[model samples]
Target: MNSRQGALLRALLNAGDYKTAGEYGRELGCSDRTVRSDVKALNAALAREGFHSHVDRQRGAGLRIVVVPDEENRLVRLLGEAEAEMHPRYERLCQEMLALTCHPGPHTADLLARRMFRNKQQIQADLHWWQGVLELSGLSLSLGRYLKVEGPEWTIRGFVMSMLFSFPAPAVRRRILPSLVGSLDPYDRQFLERCIAEMQRDLGFEFSSNAQWQFGVYLCIMVTRIRLGHSLAAWRDAREPGPFFAYLQKRLERHFSMTVSDAEMGLLRDMANCCTWQWSLAAMEAYEPTERARALADAIASALADAFGAPVPDDMRKPLAILLESGLARRGCGLVAPNPNEEAVKYEAMDGACLLSSVLAEVPALVEADLFSPDYARLLLVLFDYLEQVGALRCYRVGLVVNCGIDLALWGAHRIEKLSSRLQVTDVLTENEVAAAAARPGSALAERFDFLVSFEPLDVKFPSVTISPAVSRADIDHIIASVPLWRRGREVRTAWEQEVLPVGPSPEGLFAALHGRLVDEGLVDMPRERFEWLLWTLSIVKDRTLVLAWCGPGVRRTGIRIFRLEEGDGAECGRCTMAAVLVVAPADRGDLTPLTQGFKRLVEDYADTSGAVNDDGFFVCFPDPE
Candidate 1:
């Protein structure tokens, strides 16, 4: 079926009730006749494929899909395959790569182009982009009389496995694989699945659904690649496979009639170790992380400290080390955690994600090895939990000011503290003290407390949430809402600020000028090259101009420098007429939220020095230094 027909079929299948042709037409923005024609064509195609499913239509009630119980799986698979075919470019690229990697013989350009249903020119363009992707994995796309991907067998497998699992759903991957490798024998597939299930039972644990699928798919791919004359050499350095491998090996030989090698068996064992598994409490107690896992954990901890500008408690390392060890094999195999909530975690904790990215960057070993994936969100979530449990997370200090007696004031403070771990009642204050602090914005109280929680409404410069003496749910919600606003609006005390002179249009010129100024002021005390690398690597903050900020080693103090280009100097920084450079000291990294807010405001005010000012904001962040 064509792309539009595929879309129409999907809509019909997903629709809960009979949808009229007119209704479908309106939703798809087509005519009723066109919808009917597509539906008719889809039915014809399904019949031609000998499928027991069809779109049932009634005169007045409209259309619905009818599927027999036995045909349900087959029809669903067909729909999925059709959906995949909708994205020709991506599907073709994946198909081409699979064909090249699985077959040792060079594939002629014409053959690939024909199989992909594309012209030679389009195929060549795809090859060009695919070439760069391979190069990143240290693999080369060999192009000449024919095309092939030249790389180590292990690397090739890892890259392809990474691509396959990238689809997230194991079902989608299962469908795609058969198309690439021709048809898969139902018995062979079931045997491999059974082998994984048996292996899990033998280990006295259960692999997660996705992990089980991973093991099965890995086995299938390994066998296919091996049969196609691509197999890994014996890993002499690694330990030999155990009982489970022997069980799987015997099954593979009996089912597929293929003799499994020691190297292949070892690879399977390593993969099993990395797959996400659930164990009994007794199993957990008996487990200990390897030396390599502990070392990786230490590196991660060091990176976390650098990112947060605070010391990570040594005790936290053990749990992290355990997790690192559990996933070590899968990570090396380029598998990501099968986390359904990954996107949700990222959306909710964006700042935390930014912080984690910066932290993970410090661990060069992880990045170099491609161990850090979208699954980094898991690490960030764990770190946040650990900090909350240990009370080391940066808390929004709240000053409780009440007209009630000290008893009620303390009680209210206690209630507020229970609302969120990120909120801490730093002090119970009377109205007079809050008034006094308002007069002195730089007072010890003003600096200490982020915002105030008052029983009575008070005129104060600091953000305050007026609540009842007995805090209610609504009051709790209000406080929660205000905390974020306070983070974005509060004033920040910087060590210094200055306007930068024109440093030309080149990044080199700008870097040299800023590095010299910072060194002269003793704000940065690092080698010129290192600092220059940092300035570029740091995340940019866009507020009319690209602002780059970093809190780490070279930064001797917290400071911000403003740059305003002359009119017609928009080309100086690529459409930006102004820029702000902020250096945050390690100790003051906790102040990043307010400092960034303050700098944003500062940049907005100074953003229009030139008449040709762009109102857009740009900000980028990099890893914190060691």
Candidate 2:
């Protein structure tokens, strides 16, 4: 079947029920007639593969896949990533872009386009898109196809690696690195491995399993390219190498049968830095605010509970706090480490991540951390894991596979997970394993997933959806619209959406009101230095403050977040931050009964909660204006 047919099949299989041709067409980035033709082709392919399943047409509801239990895996193998082969025009262009960046040379645009399975015009359009994205790198597409990625050498290498490999799942990443490293000529691989081990031993620390695996991947990629006569330029002289790297290189060259090139040594030196980089107590303190950061973490856990109107277990606080501190340090200090789970985390726990990052970034201290990075996604995953451990996140099992190119596989899986918060996905297959499972009958993978999602139809008897690798925005919309119909979905979807609602009002107004109230009530505690500093930080933006304030005219009471930073011997509140809600509407002001009731619960909740709360906790200095 053509790529379009495979995509059509995926969309159909993924659907909870039949969708009309127009709906399918809109999702696959194609026309109704094309979708119909592709569906016809897909059914024929299914039959030819001896699968007792076909795309069945419904007059009004749309098309659905009719599946026989035993034939699922075979169908998926027939359509997965191996078959896609840069089939979509856009994918070919993407590959072309990578090829241009990694191995750029003189060639006409027409020649490159033909090589990429595209017409010249389509290639040019893609180049324009690439231009916009690549402008950050000062890279541009030369019209004649002589692609130039002009930037610092290290940046270009990293960008090429990102585009070249399909680093999708953590399992796949761990599995792939060894295979790639092992495939290298025994002497080179062995020597490199021994050097890494020796470095760890001599450095008085071991690299995390993840760091080692990624270093291996980096080495394998760089070595493979070097063997193919592509190596980075000698970016720095030998005299400038890190001390540990210099030592590690000398030991390696002493054992190797061949002389290592300066370029190769440069790469080796980089690997050394990556493996040894640590975020120690001192390093973290360089960013400051560990205690305050811990308080922010407590407030977030508390805020999430209050915002969602659910109680969080006390057990999640410490782990969440640790995750936040590490994330802030890593992002703030520019500690770029390899995190294979970044995609998976972004997919699985996006809302929790959004909420946490949204809360953390409000503090003036953390502005440097672009909490929106994939790093934050990885960090958020840790928080979600903690929540799940404490029975707060509410997760479910999902089985997912991507049969298309690596780009779509990662992108689609991320999209699927982001579109639903309940799903805890397991995607372990590499290109070969997926191909093997697709060709074999009754694979073990079928038993693990409650439902399988694949771009290719699988051969197993498990429930599976075959979607196009090129899942469009329309497809995502349709899938999101269908979430409530999934099993145990109604409550899950509702909670997921509200996990990170936007706070309103401008920064100046939010802080001014809070500051004015604290001063007016003689509750503005702490020295002028500390209070003003806090004000300067918190007042920078209402969006950045971690306060949980709910305001509406119909509310019978207010639930405003108040945090007392620390305690002092005297009666003065020491370093506090609180947002007050003023009631302007007359109808809801009949009694302070609701106020008392709400405050009781909030006080009860925040009592056990560790935040900036003082010993005289949850005190309301402002009396009711009414």
Candidate 3:
């Protein structure tokens, strides 16, 4: 089946209800006639294949699939296999990347084209894609005569691991990684898988499915690389041996006839920590959060709760805190994992992400952390979005009204509570009350609630939805859809822009210019010497192209300025190209950590890499009105 046909089939199966062809066409980006044609073809194929399912079209209600309950699983499985067969790009990319990394070569585009059965143009496109991927890790792919990835050994290894385990689905990774590794024999791959399973059993805890796959893939790559004489001997470490060092050391030597050094064992230990909770009680004891991590996590959780105007439950708070702790450690090591869902999250939750960045910037403890990267925000965004789905961040305070008897109005209130845990019926309003609220848009009745829902038509200045007194399915769906519109109106704030400044020779000089602006605008009255000292002491250089500095307490505003680092201008400030400078004021608790982190997030969103800034300047944010 083609991708569109497969998508149509999956949608019908997932919905399990009738939907008009027009709806499917709009959702799948096709015409109504095309959707109907695909459905007809898909049904014939399903019947021919002996699947006990067929898409049945209804006159007005639209089309839905009729599936035998027992055959549903098999039908879904077949559909998935067909979809995988249709899209082989991800698998090919994995194979091409592994090929370049494993063999030493000026692996030319011509050679890759022949090996992968693609034209040179296709191979070049692949190379371009790889360039973007490597750039995320601050690495580069040399495209001269042959293709080769160039970077520090540790970074290259991390990149490989990230790529291999990036696809979170266990079944997909298991099917892809082993077959892509050209050097690993079937017996050896199985041995490594068995070894990972044994380790998990011995540790008295099962690795999460994704972790199990990650562990197996990591060992396979490491062993294959080692056999190829690419040992990480130069990657030195003097730390004590890990708890699993002895155990893993014996297994590798016994099975592969190779012994591992302390550095290799240390690497294994770190990987294990990331893949599982702990190996033993001692490890758990040693894994206690540092005081800084705990404080920052608490502050983040509290800020998130405040922004949503809801109390985060202990279950939600605990995971968020743990993520912050690990995120802080990962940032310290300069290891940022790619957020597979970054673009999707950014598109779907733009308002939440912006508000979250603002809240994080105000966090007092976040100043000491380097955890303000896009990957980190994406992770938090995914979590926050998930929490909203599960009703943990449910803050839709709704007002209820009915033209029926008081008893029915009370019943409608309870029905709304059952319709979705997200809606809270804060008040049951009378006709007179509704009229009063309509007259005064800023009345307590209007201000105290988010939206009004009534069984009958009621004129009110507040956002209102009309629903059945019994809350029908259509009404529930309408309420569900309206929530986001209300949320957007409440959460999205207007961001003000400031003037960009020219790149100064040094951060000290930049601060002098900014100090002059703040002084003239009546924003700050600090002496130049003190501002210079803060710039020197409280600044962070990132990607050799961006700098963030704290403009100590009592400043009236927080802003970001893009400084033009013309040609070699950045060298003086330890930057290589056009750089961004963030000047932040202290948060309420007397620390600039929150604002610094927040500004980093803003920079990530607005910094133009595609030559969008022609004036040698990029200024994006303004001071908080408060």
Strongest candidate by lDDT:
1
Q: Which ten residues in a row have the lowest lDDT in candidate 2?
A: 616-625
Where model 1 places Cα greater than 4 Å from the true spot, the runs are 1-88, 103-106, 180-182, 277-288, 294-319, 334-370, 373-377, 400-416, 426-448, 453-459, 465-490, 493-550, 554-583, 590-626
Q: Return the candidate ranking by lDDT, descending.
A: 1, 3, 2
The window of 10 residues in a row where model 1 has the poorest summed lDDT is 617-626
Task: List candidate 3 segments past 4 Å from native.
Answer: 6-19, 41-56, 63-84, 103-110, 144-146, 166-175, 234-238, 277-318, 325-356, 362-397, 403-411, 418-422, 429-450, 456-462, 468-477, 480-626
lDDT head-to-head 2 vs 3, winner = 3
Model 2 backbone overlap count: 20
Record all residue pairs in model 3 with backbone atoms less than 3 Å apart, i.e. clashing.
Answer: 106-146, 107-147, 361-594, 361-595, 367-593
Q: Kindly indicate the candidate among 1 and 2 with the higher lDDT.
A: 1
So what's the TM-score on candidate 2?
A: 0.43
Compose the digit string of candidate 2's lDDT tens values, residues 1-626.
Answer: 56566556666666746788887765555678978888888878777777888888988778889877866665654545333231433235435654564343555667667766668887677666565445534455555436555555555555544433332224234332333444467787776677668766765656766556556656665655554455556654344555766676566557543344665665565444443333444333333334745786666666556544564555455554545555554332223444445534532333344334334444444444344243444446556654454444334455666545667667777877776555556673554565576567666554555455566667654445555666655555433332322222111111000011122123333344554544444433334443333333222111111332212222233223343321133221212222322221223222222232343234333422222111110111111111
lDDT tens digits, residue span 1-626, model 1: 76567767767876746889887776555788988999999999999999878999999899998977798778766866554455454456667777787655659778888877878888787777677567756799988888888877766777777666554343346546766445357777777777777876776666667667766667777878877777677653377687768767787777777677788887777666665533345544555667887888888877666655667776567666656765666556544444434434443333344345445645776554344333454566567765555444356878888877778977897788787666789788889977886787456665677788888898876778888876866677567545434553364566546564566544555667777877887777888876665544343434235555566666787787876643234434434456667667768766655565565556555653322111111100111110
lDDT score, candidate 2, position 614: 13
Candidate 3 global TM-score: 0.64
